[model samples]
Target chain A: MTVPDPRFSLNQWTTRHWPIPDLVSGCVARGVRGVGLWREPVAEYGLARTAKLMGDEGLTVTSLCRGGFFQEKDAIAENRRAIEEAAELGTPVLVLVSGGLPEGSRDIDAARARVAECLAELAPYAGSHNVQLAIEPLHPMYASDRCVVSTLGQALDLAAPHPPEQVGVVIDTYHLWWDTAAYDDIARAGAEDRLAVFQVADWVTPLPEGVLTGRGMLGDGCVELRRFREAVEATGYTGPIEVEIFNEELWAMPGPDALTLTLDRFAEHVV
Target chain B: MTVPDPRFSLNQWTTRHWPIPDLVSGCVARGVRGVGLWREPVAEYGLARTAKLMGDEGLTVTSLCRGGFFQEKDAIAENRRAIEEAAELGTPVLVLVSGGLPEGSRDIDAARARVAECLAELAPYAGSHNVQLAIEPLHPMYASDRCVVSTLGQALDLAAPHPPEQVGVVIDTYHLWWDTAAYDDIARAGAEDRLAVFQVADWVTPLPEGVLTGRGMLGDGCVELRRFREAVEATGYTGPIEVEIFNEELWAMPGPDALTLTLDRFAEHVV
Candidate 1:
């Protein structure tokens, strides 16, 4: 049997319904060596137990799913806890989905400023935990509700003030593929040593209602996945390429079947 | 009765079902001095008849809705005819929604280049007709299917090659309000004399399926409508401000009532 690509990391959300033990064993069975863990699932499974299980199975915790929803009142304290969790899990990266506008707020600039401020507040704590904060810019469609950071350049700008080891930006193909400046920003991210986690997902059309779960599977949509992978690699990024699709159909499939499909597509289209 | 804001123009698609004759008379009755026309409705109403009706009613045609699906085989010829129609209707701007990536094609760069090539072919014809081909950069969400030009800066870049009077850019607030560089691009457009048309539609969340007809009514969402207006005016743009919403609920209203609400919203939230 062919071993899975060494760089292939399954983001937990890809097989969201899979029980923790089943997901770990399924990844092991498939020879997938890396997994990005979401905070909720890790917490639900008992963080220490999840960490011990991955460690025992010789799997690397590639990154913790997220830590930045600065729009919330308790965001800083919550992110502090998230940083500690990442440290306990032995992951080097913590992804940040900066929350969008405050309730009924038309002031995007203020919201963005708040993200920068929150990063400054949390960077030291994250750095002390040896976890790099990876700011993930969502697609512009989610600019109002999900994430205010809507471009890689904007993410880089937000990360500029922080130490590269403490705060960096995520280059998710699904979000940045539409940006004309993405390639340049990728090169910039590398030059500045700010490239953190690289996530893969495809862009599909006629986006579903609420526009959140309609992410296309790798190789299924028009996104130049291989090209994006090469671009990130060309920027000296040798990090695990996390498959983070959010398609409902894919999620409906049994976890192992979905993993097999994703592995095949990732090999065919991304790597 | 108070006259509608003199700069206000109702894009016909905002009242998609309003009959042309009724729409014309309704605008006249409501003191709306300007209206933007769409190609299909104008063709159905007879382009010459629509022109004559608007002229006879002393109403200005703010713009001809669009003319730039360069992905189509016969785009140049179609746009040439659109230019002639815009000339006949006495409108100075022809809004161009540069078509999306061709069927199953991922070469956005090539699609964008096609827009430039088509512009080169149509600019002279449009210039001779006293009409500017206004490339309207859609929101990034529409980048794949509706228009490849997805940022005001990119629209300005595309317009840079042609004479400002012959080729320009459309600043639709609904498409550009999320862009951080939109304000700067507006200033650049003004400096370059490339601001041809200004349109408005608010953006509400929970985007419906397809995401096309989900534009919010003015003042109903988070857009800073009046601020966007000030930014345009600050750039010396004194042209018509077209209200071009596409909400299903708005379309279901009586045309007159919709017009009244829009005018009221414009006065309260946009002017």
Candidate 2:
């Protein structure tokens, strides 16, 4: 029988309250197929230790939480380190959060130029490792202090000069659901086989913490999850739509409770 | 002598600390000739009352702050009323802050479509009154709650099917500055004669209210005002580069004092 809706994967960030191994185990107990993890936790658990845990617990990593920030005057050394980490995790796609405007700089175009240059320099390193870079266009609020890549189309353009298999985009419904060209961008990425990862989250009300705390739990906000999912699926991306909400309230809840809610919401609203 | 920076104007929301009349007198007092004003104070002062005040004070009403909540069911009626007020104010442009995702609705595309349809319907009404409808692409932070139009490129596309003279964009630095395509959009807007209003404000720390406090006090934030002015001017539309800041702290300050500071920055950084 065809799966009811699509399978739901959980990013540890949504349940940041739990330990990484516990998050892995908790996800498995709840019938979650995959987990998106961060480098620091993996490093803390030791990549070998975490990979072992994921294997024993039978958890599939949807994608790595991120690897980007290719800015600054000399960023080669930093990017190389990130690449090595992604390779160690053995995740299929390494999510890359393109960083924001540098402090004391006013020219975003110049800053974006720096990102493009960094990507070109790091492309060979990323290529050598068999790691794919997924450029996640963050919310525009973070545009000043976070990622400068703000749209899927812009991300596609940045990826154009590089090999699509090497560099692609991560479509988090939270970051891109509001964009006018979101559907078109996803279709184009899928057409080119550069639709690297599918991330799920919601844009919340009252927009807490201004920048970070405001991301809603999937069902809490108004993003059309089914529409967003359909758009990605239409792009021929058969990958899992990972739930990656960055919420404080959800974090305070018990990990299993959050996981249960996430799964339920995924089935009810998204799937 | 050629004006050093002829495109500069003042958006009163920047120095929101000041009363509208004080902002008007201050704009003239400080050699800043154009102004973008919100409706609340105009309503408080009465539109006819404020219009003659602007004329008497020799201030150019660059654009009225807004005239679109185009997503609501009654958006046509709402916008018609807004157009009447904008025309009454004698501002050549009526800035439209597209309302956010309709609460409880998961469909962003549908909301965006509604906004577009509203614009299409209002375009004629605005044209008849000689009020150019300026679609202000709000910061993406507001995508779910406020303006769904979140990029200059998106706004341009929304305005594309309409005549540039009748429909255009409000290139507010606070909103469009974070967009990766801001520069290209600015240049493109100018090329198409759709640069309706060039607003200035600093992207400050998100305030306690969870909104971008409109806190950029001219030189206070990282917006490249000079370069932005240069880019807009290059567009061949020598319209007012209005300083439109929405800072609460600035609003708390005495309006005249805020005006004084706004003018000083306009001369130093903008002009």
- Residue B74, model 2: Cα distance from true site in angstroms: 3.9
TM-score of chain B of 1: 0.99
Q: Candidate 2: which stretches are off by over 4 Å?
A: A1-6, A72-74, B1-8, B206-209
Using lDDT as the measure, the top candidate is 1
Chain B TM-score for each model? Answer: 0.99, 0.92
How well is each residue in B48-119 modelled by candidate 1, as lDDT tens digits? Answer: 899999989999999998899899889999999999999999999999999998999988889999999999
Cα deviation at A268, candidate 1, in Å, is 0.6
**Model 1 residue B258 distance off true place after TM-score fit, in angstroms:** 0.4
DockQ of candidate model 1: 0.84
The lDDT of each candidate is 0.94, 0.79
Task: Please give the clash total of every predicted structure, in order.
Answer: 0, 14
Residues B1-271, candidate 2, lDDT per residue (tens digit)? Answer: 1232445676666665567777777666656677777888788878898989988888778888777776667878877887888888788898898888676877777888888888888898899988899999888777777788888888989999999878999887777777667889999998888988788777765544568564588887778877777788788867887777666677788766776777677778876
